[model samples]
Target: MLETSARLLRLLSLLQTRPEWSGPELAERLDVSVRTVRRDVDKLRGLDYPVEVDLGPTGGYRLGAGAALPPLLLDDEEAVAVAVTLQTAAGSGGVGVAGLGEAAVRALVKLERILPSRLRRRVAAVPVSTVMPLRAMPTVDPTALVAVGAACRDRRVLDLDYTAHDGTVTRRRVEPHHLVSWGRRWYLLAHDLGRDDWRTLRLDRLRPRVGPDGLATGPRFVAREVPGGDPAAYVASKVADVRAAFRCRVRVAAPPDVVRERLWTDQARVDDLGDGTSRLHLAADHVDGAVIMLVGLGLEFVVESPDELGEALRALATRCRKAANGTSGGRVGAPAELG
Candidate 1:
């Protein structure tokens, strides 16, 4: 009886390793007869596992979706990976999804409870900590995320109502290709049918069109190659264009390569001037923010455009001089008394 049970578990594990398995292949792996494989498959079916049979010349079996989720079998490596990922999600205040942290905690508890002592030790050895930002990030609807993810996987078209930053709402029909998770936000990289262009849309701003049946996903689409053949790079460029309010130029006393290494590729563009200096084009929401970034670079720079940026730099320098001379709180050039 124990041997049969062990074989059944092994069979289930083998089936999960891939989408489909031939009867002869399974028999060879188990060192059992084809008849025994069929009998075991029947037993698994009796236990409510949806084992589907393919009755073609190349006969095979596959696991199908059932009403309820079956217990999953995981190898040692997969078990550790899942435990670590769950720990991260649990620590991260939910990754921009409402109630995700609590859900991750619940799932982690269940997984850890069933984990072997060796695996538990492995999971516990890794520590995870998350520091939340002061600003509130937009949260995505879990249902909408799931619907869009399913559409991406199934190559289906999605009709969505999207809210722009200016509070304008417009309906869009898109063929979603991928979901890109950046920081605490989720973005969809899709081809816009109406505009005849590719668009990176925020998941929070999207409302999937629903019919009486459920999420109204349309016909499957032939997937297109992403712009530049890289989805992440394309999305990053699009996000930078949308978020940057001030495109300020500066001449920095550094080589182009050095400046590029110090700044994020999406945040700044550096061009070599061939005289030990480089031109830096960066985007920021405000001139003060640009001033802070340039000062933090630890290199000498001259603001080239946006006279307001130069004014901000002058203002910052004056404030710093006042603070340094202990005259910021009192009268000009007055030394502060030691407490």
Candidate 2:
């Protein structure tokens, strides 16, 4: 009886991993007769597992879809993979899918309880943490998420009411294309009929209404692969008038690799100048962030056009001189900046 239970478990694991397994293949793997394999398959079916048998020269036994979710049988590597993914999602802020992270943790706890000693240690060693910046106090209804997702999937037009970051609200009609999640934020890529252009919408701010039939839904927006699918650059472009107000162009006397590593999210562009130097072009909303970043790079750089940035740095230098002469608060020549 113990041997039968073990074999049944082994068979269950195999079925879950692969789409189909012939009766002879299962018999060979289990070191049992074809009749024994058939019996075991029956036992699995009796436990409410929908094991479908295909009768043909090329046919085999397959684990078919059931009406409800079934208990998954996972192996060592699969278990570890699941545990690690659960830990990550649980910590990726409460934006993408609400309560998903918490549910994952709960499920992981139950799974860990049944894990062997080595597996348990591995799962426990993986740490999870959430760093949600600027809490987006918008609740996304599950029904709206589902409805819009379906529209995007099936190619449908949707009427939506969206509130901008500055609290200005407007109603828009659009053709849904794709949904993008980037660093605790969700954006819906869609074709705007009113403006006749593609626009990205914040999912949290959307009040989606089902549109009538006959309105054409656009063709799928072919996505260009991006590292991590993060649209940070695109979002930053729409930041504020100040972003376009001043452009800070600086040539760093350092290797391109070093400059790339030092450049932060605010930078508009970074290019290798060759000959062990790099050029950085960035929008400066606040002169302080730009000047501080340049100083932080610790590399010699020439400030090109948009002399306002240079003026800001000069003003900061004057302040430092004043502090050196005991004029400003904090230590002398410290520039009154974060170390």
Best by TM-score: 1
The segments of candidate 2 whose C-alpha lies over 4 angstroms from its true place after superposition are: 1-82, 89-92, 95-111, 114-121, 124-158, 165-168, 173-175, 210-247, 252-285, 292-301, 311-339
RMSD of each: 5.7, 8.2
Point out the worst 10-residue segment of candidate 1 by lDDT. 330-339
Candidate 2 on 23-135: residue-level lDDT in tens?
A: 99999999999999999999999999888898978678877667665678887888998988877776764356666657777887888788899997887787766666433
Over 1-339, each residue of candidate 1 has an lDDT whose tens digit, in order, gives 999999999999998877679998999999999999999999999999999998988559988667787889999999999999988888887888878889889999999999999999999999888776535788998888888887887688999999998999999999999999864688999999999999999999999986554454498789999989988767766765665777789999999878766663245666789999999888876776677678878889988898888887877777788789877866766763221
* TM-score versus the correct structure, for each prediction: 0.74, 0.52
What TM-score would you give candidate 2 relative to the actual structure? 0.52
